[model samples]
Target: MSRAGLAAERTALAWRRTAVASMITGALFLNHAVINGWRPALIAPIGAAVAMAALAGLSYLRNRSLREGRHSRGGWVVATASATVVAVAVLAFVIEFTDPLP
Candidate 1:
């Protein structure tokens, strides 16, 4: 692969790493929700996990397009994914630290 392709691969790998970390956060949130005996609290983390999976899939597709000499607005995708991950994390924290029933 060319150096440019390698760079793209590296960036994609970084995104994947971030996604994996977010998955861990999701797991923790889900676990905490279960411990707290609140079934609804699982929603936020579950959604985050689903989003992470989608993001990962997009990253793979973006990489494939890159290898195929197709233009991909990966920067936008990465930025959006990162923001989503951050939002999910914030939501999880809010749900975790606040009382939902009272």
Candidate 2:
């Protein structure tokens, strides 16, 4: 394969790793929510998990595009992923600092 092909392969692999990481993070968030019980206060963790799942889905889409050689205008995808991460981080912060409902 050519250099460009190898680079694309590497990028695809990176995306796959990112997807896996996102899934793991989502699982952790879900686990935290479960461990904390079925209180309304656990919604933040649940939302974080959903965001992580969306991130993983986005990563999968990007990876598929790379594999199919349709590498056009990925800026939106990256932007969305960034926003998701920021949102998840905020949710996590809220979850960590807030007192559990009585």
Candidate 3:
């Protein structure tokens, strides 16, 4: 394969890695919610986990696009990913404030 093809392959692999990471993050968030017991405040972590799942879905779509050579700018994917991260951060802050340690 040419250098350009190799580059695209690398990009696709990167996206796959990102999707895996997002799934792992979502699992961790879910685990936290479960461990903390089923309080209403635990909803924040549950929501965060759902957001992470969405992020993973987006990553998968981007990866598929890259693999298929449909190389438009990924501005939407980047923006959405950024928004998801920010939202997750905010949710984490809320969870921390609402769930006081013993």
Estimate TM-scores for all models: 0.64, 0.89, 0.88
Candidate 1 local lDDT, 1-102, one digit each (tens): 788878766765675676566566656655666666756646666676677667666656665665566656667876877787788768767765774553
Report how far residue 100 has shifted in candidate 1, in Å. Answer: 8.4
Worst lDDT run of 10 residues, candidate 2, spans 93-102
Tell me the spans in candidate 3 whose CA falls farther than 4 Å from its real position. none
Q: Give the alpha carbon lDDT tens digit for every residue of 1-102 in model 2.
A: 989888888888888888999999999999998877878877778888898998999899899989998767678988998898888888877777784653
At residue 37, give the lDDT of candidate 3. 86
Q: What is the lDDT of residue 14 in candidate 2?
A: 84
Local distance difference test, each candidate: 0.66, 0.86, 0.89
Cα displacement (Å) at residue 66, model 1: 4.2
Candidate 3 C-alpha lDDT tens digits along 1-75: 889889888988998988998899899999998887888987789989999999999999999999999878898
Query: What's the ranking of the predictions by TM-score, best on top?
Result: 2, 3, 1
* Candidate 2 off by > 4 Å: 99-102
TM-score for predicted model 2 compared with the true structure: 0.89
